[model samples]
Target: MVTPGPTSPMSPAAWAGRRDARNLRAPVKKSRRPRLRRKQPLQPLNTSPLPGDSGVCDLFESPPSSGSDGADSPAARGCSHAPGAAQQLAQLDLQTFRDYGQSCYAFCKAREGHFHPRESLALQPQVTAESRCKLLSWLIPVHRQFGLSFESLCLTVNTLDRFLITTPVAADCFQLLGVTSLLIACKQVEVHPPRVKQLLALCCGAFSRQQLCNLECIVLHKLHFSLGAPTISFFLEHFTHARVEARQAEVSEALEAQALARGVAELSLADYAFTSYTPSLLAICCLALADRMLQLPRPMDLSLGGHPEEALQDCLGKLQLLVAINGTSLTHMLPLQIREKCCLSPSLK
Candidate 1:
């Protein structure tokens, strides 16, 4: 059921074409820009820590009462708010992690659906599919700017969607929610999370530090502190390693294909349609399509993932449509060598 893969000649390009596109969230910086908040950095919440627990603050606090002071907020501290104690993970070193990688993948896959939201926007009275896309477009560039890993991006979207599913949000507060989700996701996987102020600065200071801190607590509470979700990034890396170990494809070829697949996966993040598919399924389909696109020799054994063929085909077909639509952006996102050789498969056209 898969459509013909777009044969993108890869090259030095990486997310090149899209950065210039107007950020739905860039802070106004010129005379044409405003020192004031309008759309970029719109206001969201206010924060103050709950009483006690001085070693670390509560990951969440009840909304401030009319009688309370707002002194313990992230703004009050002048630093990135560390995710409260609840989000901390036990130390698992790289060698130890690799030794138990498969078991870890199993644990993550089992919990993916528990953390994932089905038709998340169906609950939103204000946010729409288009709005979600716009928000993600801006987020992609922001994440790249921050030099965050792809795993963080996946978890960020998961946190965003799941929180939206459980809460009713205002259109005005949606942008704040987006950054708040990113912050929470960063805490999960990033060693040096972006400062609350840095994120707000990108939004052009439309959102205050307090509002972001407040929302962080709300998201953590709403999701019940379940942050370790499976991601396409994890599965993509997993399948790529398996391909190399099986000696099904040359390391160079597999790496190139994996790079292209990552761009595809990033595009998928903005797309709500792909959300219902599990990370493992999407990762396999992406690997399959990448092989076809890069035309890698001795392609990966898809059976290793153990997903049904029909499900693979269905996801592959939709991903083809997505690649076709974003063919130019995808090309620009690839390295220069591949960019020159790459062409969208005729079938996609």
Candidate 2:
């Protein structure tokens, strides 16, 4: 008989059970029984050992049971499971959102004054209003290159203005601050934000990815995460929808006019003089100016955005000047048909 070898690390009962299970199999002839069989580790039933396993224990990790801790994920609970994409469109009712459009605009209109920048540049020691204008001018073309929505650009400018007042930014970092604001605004509204690498590439690698990310956190924290401010795009759409509903303009005409007005609004965004005007005032003036420039059969009323006549005229004067100054650049921003339809030329006027 072959001498019995040292026992396996398994419990006595477990070893006995294992021996009983092995005995049930066909007995090996002595000539075929290898000597090393006695020295090999006894593996538990129902499990094959992995190549590198030490085999001290045979317990398996299970998925994280929901509500167990209510916070830990499967990965946190010692398993590697990725979660599903979050549902941003859950519980949306398109008809209801459209139906409530006017009411939503009214809510924002009532809050417009709260969002207007008050002496916004007073605290920036290194940055000047001229610098602000130049930065926004560059940003307008950048926004077009990315094909971001007018709302995204409006939100970006709003975010930048709100954050600018909260901290004194260095002139050197103003461009970075602008791009960081764009990123935050895109995250708030766009389906896919531009990649950080791409945005930095636009800057010719003047800023690092970490610097952009760090400034993003600083902006979000400084604003206390409040980003739902009323914007020029919001009020502009409201006025256009109202005009269409009132039958003062054709659907297609209103759309074209709104596009022209959006270009006007973008032009205004680059001028520091226009920042102090409430968004509703600026939006109405842009729409009204667009309609007058287009010479619509029935132009929208100046009172549509609910500003007084005096404020309306004042804002309108500034918008007319802005349009006159940037006529060439604004024309480039619009569709060819829209530019031709609106007569920026003095002879046409």
How many steric clashes between backbone atoms does each model show?
A: 23, 0
State the lDDT of candidate 1 residue by residue for 1-349, as single tens digits: 9899888764545445455464447687766654665667657555566567672444445533433254335343222111122211211123444587678778877887776688999979999989999999999878876767778889999899999899999999999999999999999898789999889998888889999999999989989998888889888877766666566776566666776788899899999898889888888888888777876657667788888988988999999999999998887666665666556667667
For model 2, residues 1-349, the per-residue Cα lDDT tens digits are 8998997588999889999998797767767655565667877565544456764433543333443353233223222111111211211223454699768987887887777777789999998989999898888767766757678889999999998899999999999999999989889887777899989998999999999999999999999998888898888777777776677887677777887888898888888888879888888888888988898888878867667889898888888888887788877777667777887535223
Segments in model 1 whose C-alpha atoms lie over 4 Å from true places:
1-98
The lowest-lDDT stretch of 10 consecutive residues in candidate 1 is 81-90
Using TM-score as the measure, the top candidate is 2
Can you give the lDDT of residue 98 in candidate 2?
Answer: 68
User: What is the C-alpha local distance difference test score of candidate 1?
Assistant: 0.77
Error of 1 at 286 (Å): 0.9
List ranges where model 2 is wrong by over 4 Å.
1-98, 345-349
